[model samples]
Target: MFERLISYLDSVRARDPAPRSRWEILLYPGVLALGLHRVAHWLFEARLYFLARFVNHFSRALTAIDIHPGATIGKNFFIDHGFTVIGETAQIGDNVTIYQCVTLGGSNPTNGKGGKRHPTLMDNVIIGSGAQIIGPIVVGERARVGANAVVTEDVPAGATMIGLKARSTLVPAEDWLREFIPYGTPCDDPPCDEQGSPRRDCIEKLEAEITSMREEMALMKAMLAECAAPPTPVRIRKSAAKE
Candidate 1:
């Protein structure tokens, strides 16, 4: 238990940019909620439902973040700014980072008796602030859900999901965040290339298409000219009708 505490504190210090003493982990609402959640989860698993609920309530009070004890969360998980939510059936994998106002919630609230209701976040996944990952969707490993994005479908691994309905994909080279971010990981498109200029691939493709279209137009003009021209008089050698 002490080792787990140390690890949780270490994660908070390493992941957050807030300058603080090591002992100050005690006051961190996200860290505090995680500490209480450990006990609450144990109690819940032990079938002590009331006690678990009580502990969960206390944790929520301490930190505005509300996580059901029934949710299965792994190690090195960090939640920033609290007020984030994890539903009962939500399963969070190791090293997942969630920002404030994020929700791993159920899309269908009416039927809650059986099966997985919430989203499953895979390892190294990051959820931006205010992003709502609803339903039983699976967010693949290393995927980033952009802030304020409403996601109901499964996200592919290493994908950057952004906007309301655009769902455009950035290149793998641009989407991968190998290092830790001070705050929550960003899910938006990366800046211009290393040279600070826009990528040339799209422009090159457009130019190639324009060239092809010009060639097609030239061929069409040649065909039209041929069709409009006077027919050449056939110099058919007149043979004396049947020698």
Candidate 2:
């Protein structure tokens, strides 16, 4: 346990290197708060409700991050630039990166009890800054939740979800990585025809040509099949008057 603690401390130090000047690297109270919250979260899970609440209150007082003790967070979870709020029932998977101002809260409209109230985030999900993922939805693995996106439904695996209700584009990760723009940009060009023309008339002409070619090919194949078939024997009954 000591070795693991030391190792985690080392990793945190590496990520947040001590600044040359003391004032430059102010040790965020949120870090210690996270540590205590982890312990409190464990206690809550272990059915030590009173103790867990005590620790939770202490941690919140110190860091101002309002994470409910019932929330299930996985390993190596880092919450940067605090003031982040997670609901009581939020389920976060492993290696999920959440930035500042991200909210994973309950969207249950009814004041009714006993139902899933928070979002379920899958593994390796990267949520950009200020993203608001709400409701009882499952965000799939390796999905990128764009900044300030209001996702209300289940996001598919390896998808990039964006927009008001989060419309997903089936763009591969490699293509997304190649782009320099951080946020998504809309295309301005008008739709093109099948034959690479701006005019609809050209598209219609091409479609007609393709349809005609298909019909001609079908007719030719039927003729070839008929020719390849064995010839039927002709009945050679002698002409009635010839005999």
Candidate 3:
């Protein structure tokens, strides 16, 4: 068990450079939350629902991270800087890293029945701060969900998702294969390029659309100007008698 704890701390250190030592990592709210969650989850599985909830509430108060007791988390799961929420049905895989204020949220079931409502994050998934991963979606392995992204659907493996209503961006091969990225966002000098991939950058797409709209607007204005220009005043030449 001590070995496992050390491994977990090492994993967090691998992702976050701020921690000077294992002791510092241990003091992190996320680390504390996960430790308390283990106790809560064990009680939950033992059918001690009240005790599980009590432990969960205590952890939340102490760490400011709320992880439902029933959530299933795999090995080396790390939450950076806490203030994150994991729903009851959320399933997390090994080596998954989630940043602050992220939510593994669920959908509203019209039938009022609960079953696998939250997200399933595959191994090596990185979710940036404030990302909202809603519904019973699967975030595939090695995928990166960028900060503030709103993801309501399944994410493909090795994809990088960003923006509201999260859209996939073309992740460079190097970034895709990289073991860890600070915030699941590439800091490329120029994020988008001419050679668009399966799903190009959302910002690039929006820029193109804006340019197209401007061109269309210009064309429409020109046509309207031509139409609205006063017709050459009818040369009502003075009648021959009135000259």
Candidate 4:
């Protein structure tokens, strides 16, 4: 418990630029909320349904972050702000970061009970502020979801999901870890085509353009060689001069 608390503080300090004191971090709403959620989850898993709900209610009243007791969350997790909603069927892996107003909820709002209604986020996933990941989808390891993205499908590992409709592009997870993404995810865009597809599409276009230019250059060189070549010898004029 002591080691985990220290790790939590260290993670927050590393990610957040603000000067932090032990007291401040200890009093942080996110920390309190996570701790409360832990106890609630234990109770829920032990089949203490009513007690688990009561503890969750108490936690939400204090922190304003609603994490369902049935949700399975792993270690070194940080919820950056209040009002974040983690659904009942949501499963979160270790070293995950979630910003304020993020929702991991079911896509079919009309029906509540089913198998795997909420999304499962793998280790090292970062979810930006206000992003909504709905349905039974899996966000792969080290994936970054940009702010306000509406993602319903699976996101690949080590990729960045950007834009309103959410487009995935490959990016190194190491590069993303060094900076404080803080869930305000932004990075250098890989070359993309008109449809926002990756550099693969652009590569074909560039190659076609290069081929056209090379053909034009070859034709110009042939014309130049023809012009530079000497005219056919005038044999009749030479013979007349000799005579």
Query: Considering TM-score, which of the candidate structures 1 and 3 is the better prediction for this target?
Result: 3
The clash numbers for all candidates, in the given order, read 0, 0, 0, 0
lDDT of 3 at 210: 100
**Once superposed on the true structure, which residue ranges of model 1 sit more than 4 Å away at CA?**
109-112, 166-168, 173-177, 181-243
lDDT of 3 by residue, 6-90 (tens): 8989989988889899999989999999999999999999999999999999999999999999999999999999799999999
Q: By summed lDDT, which 10 consecutive residues of candidate 4 come out lowest?
A: 187-196
Q: Which is the leading candidate under lDDT?
A: 3
Root-mean-square deviation of every model? 10.3, 15.2, 7.2, 7.8
* TM-score rank order: 3, 4, 1, 2
Candidate 2, TM-score vs. the true structure? 0.62
lDDT of the structure predicted as candidate 2 = 0.70
User: What's the ranking of the predictions by lDDT, best on top?
Assistant: 3, 4, 1, 2
Candidate 2 lDDT, tens digit per residue, 2-89?
Answer: 6755554543444444535433323555456667878988999899999998988887777777788888887655565577788888
Comparison by lDDT, 1 against 4, better one: 4
Question: What TM-score, over all chains together, does every model reach?
Answer: 0.72, 0.62, 0.79, 0.73
In candidate 1, what are the lDDT values of residues 1-243, reduced to their tens digit? 789777877877777767487687668787788878889999999999999999999999889989999999999888878998899899999988888998889866576575888999999888888888889889988888877888889988876676675163543644375655333334233542432323547689899999999999999999999999999986755584445
